[model samples]
Target: MDIDARTLRTFREVTLTGSFTQAARRLGYSQSSVTAQMRALERQVGEPVFERLPNGVRLTHSGIVLRDYARQILTLVGEMETALRRPAANPPRLTVGIVPALAYGQQLARVTHIGRRLLSGVQLALRIMGTAEVHDAFKAGAIDGALVLTVVDADDPADLLGEQQYADRSDDLTEVRLQEVEFVPVTGVGRRPGGHGRQVVIADPDCPSQRWLPEFLRLRCDSPPEIHELGSMAGVRAATQSGLGCAMLPTALAADHEEAGGLRPLPGVPRMRWNASLILGRHDTRPAVDRQNLTETLRQATALGRAARPAVPAAEVLGGAGLGGEVLGGGATALDPDTSIAS
Candidate 1:
């Protein structure tokens, strides 16, 4: 039986979302269109694909088998489309979501240069956003891929993206571990002005590095820090520069400001380290192979960014507060694609 790509795509969306109305909302199609497409797909297969229920739908045994093949077929079709449509002169553009804090400094420049040299025809469009925003955007297909720091706790459901749905569907997403990042406590020039608990400035509290920070700090500091939340990394930098207490930031970010006296590392404060990974698509869906290829290029580009920056060892900044070789928690796990970088 010959099945159209659009019908297969609709089927995949329905399978992922579990509800016709929800799939329609995601695909910008009417519920009627979704039902019509599902009917057409079922007719093509000569069997019912979905066991419709009051709350949602479930796939039949035949539907499960079809979805496995459909994912592979769609991936191949996507590759074919790219090969056919890509311009000879201009490379296809890729949208990549990154932690907003990394947007500035030597990292951006180095990544851009590496992309130009290594990625050949592909252009990179980087978006700076918080972790939660990154997850949502990727799920909505707003970005082609992402490099993010996620806290992995085997017991915590939030640590694993779409864990429930991922287990229920055929596994096809690409995940690759890059490298670890060190987080350090930073202040302006000196101690807090009032001698009260240091005011803690954080750009995004939901950032994986920042998630356990308050409790982490309570272990390190005498009094609990007075927390101050800001909207952007720039704002956090500005506030910390004005002696707005202490903040935990990536060593790279703190390194950027150190030479100019914009920030001073708190020598005795604890450090947090987490692994960064390049993830394509959501937990439930596999990314197109072209996107996965671009993801590898992007990781190499960022690795170049790290190498280009002047190295600031974590030991130098953490001083006595360094955890040495210890990791905070068991870091994230990845099911890697066919890439050189190990998970």
Candidate 2:
């Protein structure tokens, strides 16, 4: 019997979710379609894979055995694909997706350096997107890799690119530390207090920082403040600096404003720290040689970026900077030194 990859994938998803409806939701298929796929799979296997119950579904004995083999088969197929797709003579092009905030920092420089030195002839394509969008694009084969801040809870270890740590724990997602970020609250310079009330601008509502913002506010302030949600950090910062509201700005990016006395953190509001990660699709088809070079380039760049900047105070780092008013680096300022030093 000829078994297809799609059938295996469908079986795996159904097994994982234990409900065709849930599996279909995840796979972007209809319930009927998923059911049909499973039925076809069972026909091929000559046994029932799932037993339908009023509560949900359960895998039959054969289903369990097939699942284990299916996983192994898929993994082996992926490895084979990776091995086969390695470039021979010409260099391979690697497309990398990045969130706007990550694209602006040391990541850009590091990726560029990797392309120049290690990747040599390889072309780099950078796509700016949110973490969710990046993940979708990666899974859909739209991009080869990404640098994103994703929750660790549901992420498969095999899908992750490297080491992980807890950045923040929330109801839906556990923010993992990809890279240390310094966040500062900022408002326009010379703006009179109470002109527009206290406005808090956030990036996307789904952004990890934004997700944590309300909780942060609840802990810090008793009263509910007006909140503005923007699509991008740039938008939030711009709105805040226009005297529309106050925003949590990356320490590195907010340096100029801070130096010019345009932005300042609210009194008793602590510096926020978050983690960033380099994420890549498991199916990235770059040659092994190219993958090694690119990975090394990013690793070195991240290390250098981390080393060059002073560690933000643990309190100021994320949960709170501290009551002492110590300055921590996060935004464009942190990267400026690296650029100048490199030049």
Q: Which candidate is the best by lDDT?
A: 1
lDDT of 2 by residue, 29-54 (tens): 99999989988888989999899999
Worst 10 residues of 1 by lDDT: 334-343
Which run of 10 residues does model 2 get worst, by summed lDDT? 334-343
Question: What digit string (tens of lDDT, one per residue) describes model 1 on residues 1-343?
Answer: 9899888878877886689998786566999999999998889899998999999999999999999898678756755665566577766677888775555556667667655544444677888777667656866778877777644322233344323433332133345556556666677875543332346787766665554455445534434667888856677777888887667676766776878988876543445565566666544343344444454455555554342222233223233343333322224111122211101
Q: What is the lDDT of residue 135 in candidate 1?
A: 56
The CA lDDT at 51 in model 1 is 99
lDDT of each: 0.62, 0.59
**Candidate 2 structure lDDT:** 0.59
| Candidate that scores best on TM-score | 1
Model 2 stretches with alpha carbons more than 4 Å out: 1-91, 105-110, 150-178, 194-197, 222-224, 283-285, 300-343
